[model samples]
Target: MSYLDPETSKKLVPIGRFMGEHFTGGNWTELGFLTGCDSIVQNHPRLLRSLSFGDDDYPEACLAVVGSMVRNDPDNLKLIEDYIIEHFSESGPNISTIPGLGPTIRFSPTVFKVPTHPQDAKLVAVMMPFGPSFAGVYEAIKSACSQTQWFYAQRADDIWKDTTIIQDVFDLIFRSQIVVCDYTGRNPNVFYEAGIAHTLGKTVIPITQNSADVPSDVMHHRYLTYLNNGEGLNHLTLTLAQRLRTLDPTLAQFA
Candidate 1:
């Protein structure tokens, strides 16, 4: 009943070992759930019940379980990588087993986040000080994104999730491919969010009402300056649309 060949399954050991070591915390079930290994978990209900895996006395436990999975279906390897490892880090691990993988797995910082999530290629998150004056500006940007018919834009205040507001903001930025940050008035919160976006390696488009409002350190980056009037908003919409189309290559066209 094995789908993956012996050699192929053997190559996945490093991946399993890496997962066992680094992905600790109550995450085993979430990992299985995210990867759609429901049947595999159901088959060994007792053994798979733990939220934490391979971090205790039996270190090879997770590897053993993953070995069982790949033999049933090699596709699980790619699923775990996509839904887990790559989502966990910007740097994607080589699927191919490398020499000293066991040691190299430790070289990576121990950052375990359960319930992995993927980036939204079409999500454009806007970072700006939430206020009445900025409301028009936000709408203008949203309109600009609508021109692409491919990007969906939203700001932090637009949605409140079950988690803390700050956590919600982190999740939003984490999943976004493009982030638009307004530095007008040099708002501290906006500045902090901009730093987060930059660190996450999102394509940050800086827009401000005045050139002088742009921060000193980030002056190297070009900022789109605009007026918030009816005519100015229209112009901002047109120019921003062009910039977005140029920046986002996730799609050629979307109906």
Candidate 2:
């Protein structure tokens, strides 16, 4: 796609790569402000200086008032976010998986756009909980991975001691087509992240260990629940294969 400017590019595309994970956290409101501020200081230094107090009788009060106005003004935030979202493509996949998989079972999704043409097939992300629940779901994830080529990565935590990792996670989800969540533990962050992913129009795959962990809002939605054992692993794999068939016809071969 053609872009009119760098700002437009940042707003339109899902974050593919980043300097690090230290610049995450906050809502769109905060991101817009930061981007705007950075753009101004970098591109319009003279205008930025003009806003500050130097050799003037009005004191720093004038600059402080403008700062307050920018802070309290809803329009400013809206403008930035609108711009960001406007140029962005509303397509891609989302996977919600737990963090840190050493010798234990691990899962990740890796996605890339089909360069020659566009298709409806999506890049899916998987989110799972830690501990025994993940052990139970490990085979299921492996099955899912085998069926498709999804973008994969371990969730970033602290990025050079600068930003929260989820900020980057949100950035990734923005470009995704669907989100798969493993709610076996009823993790607060997983639930919260799933909400955000849903709000952004990502299709959500809500999986749980049992009915107890499933939220009432999503209880009505069909989900995959597996027991903890070798039998459970086999069942989960089969169930996931079937689900994949329904999601994408190409997945039928794998099923």
Candidate 3:
């Protein structure tokens, strides 16, 4: 049997019935059901409590149902959005929200605003000189996103034809609560941005693909190292995840 609430389960009835009729029906492992249990459960607890349908097991069951739909039907993006929004809000039994839900799955504007709750979180800025070399940038981004609201300001080329762009980049850096700088190439522009972020009192995370690439002056600062091969991406993810936990204990695990 499905683990979602009867109402939400109804939205998935067609698909479930179709699978039942054409495919051999199997069981949903309890452990698998909770794996993708919407991240919002931890983010918003009020909604979970409000939506609980009397039975104490309803919340977990609802979460498992939503997780199953999301994992099984990637193309049915609307359903996933509905699940996220529904869980994000503590609104009553009736509320008009997210017209086409899926399209609204993007980050909420409030997440960009200054954090009110200590855990509402700080903004993290990233300074990566050579974008192409940092495949782990994606994972690092995911790690940051999980821990705090962040914006990425990457310098594509050190030589900018228009100096005005430098100011724009500086604005992004200064607005950030923390700055992560990748010094894999000893790129001067990156060091410049790092110095600016440091002056502005933004926490700076200095990392390099190799320790040898670290600039002499910044060498005293601890740096994360990785091999340029595939393993580099994994190392970056794990290291960044650990560092992010230090930044925010609430995000000790993957968000």
Candidate 2 at 107: error in angstroms?
A: 31
With a 3 Å backbone cut-off (N, CA, C), the pairs that clash in candidate 3 are: none
Rank candidates, lDDT, best first.
1, 3, 2
Find the number of clashing residue pairs for candidate 2. Answer: 24
Question: Candidates' TM-scores?
Answer: 0.56, 0.46, 0.44
Query: Which portions of model 2 show Cα errors greater than 4 Å?
Result: 1-122, 132-136, 148-162, 249-255
lDDT of 1 by residue, 1-255 (tens): 355554555656766667655654335667667656655655654344443342253335566667777655555655665655444654463222112233222223233122145667678899988888888999999999999888889887788763666666776787787889989898888898888777656778899988888889999998798898988888888988888887544332220
Best candidate (score: lDDT): 1
Whole-model lDDT values for every prediction: 0.68, 0.47, 0.50
Candidate 3 structure quality by residue, lDDT tens digits, 25-137 = 11222212334434433344433443443434444444444445544543232444333335443431111111222222232232123223221124566677655656556
Off by over 4 Å in 1: 1-115, 250-255
Error of 3 at 120 (Å): 9.5
Q: How far off is residue 189 in model 3, in Å?
A: 0.4
Candidate 3 at residue 69, lDDT? Answer: 51
List, residue by residue over 133-236, the lDDT tens digit for candidate 2.
46547556656646555422232231222254565556555444456687876898789778866655566777777789988997888888877677887887
Q: How close to the true structure is residue 246 of candidate 2, measured as C-alpha lDDT?
A: 57
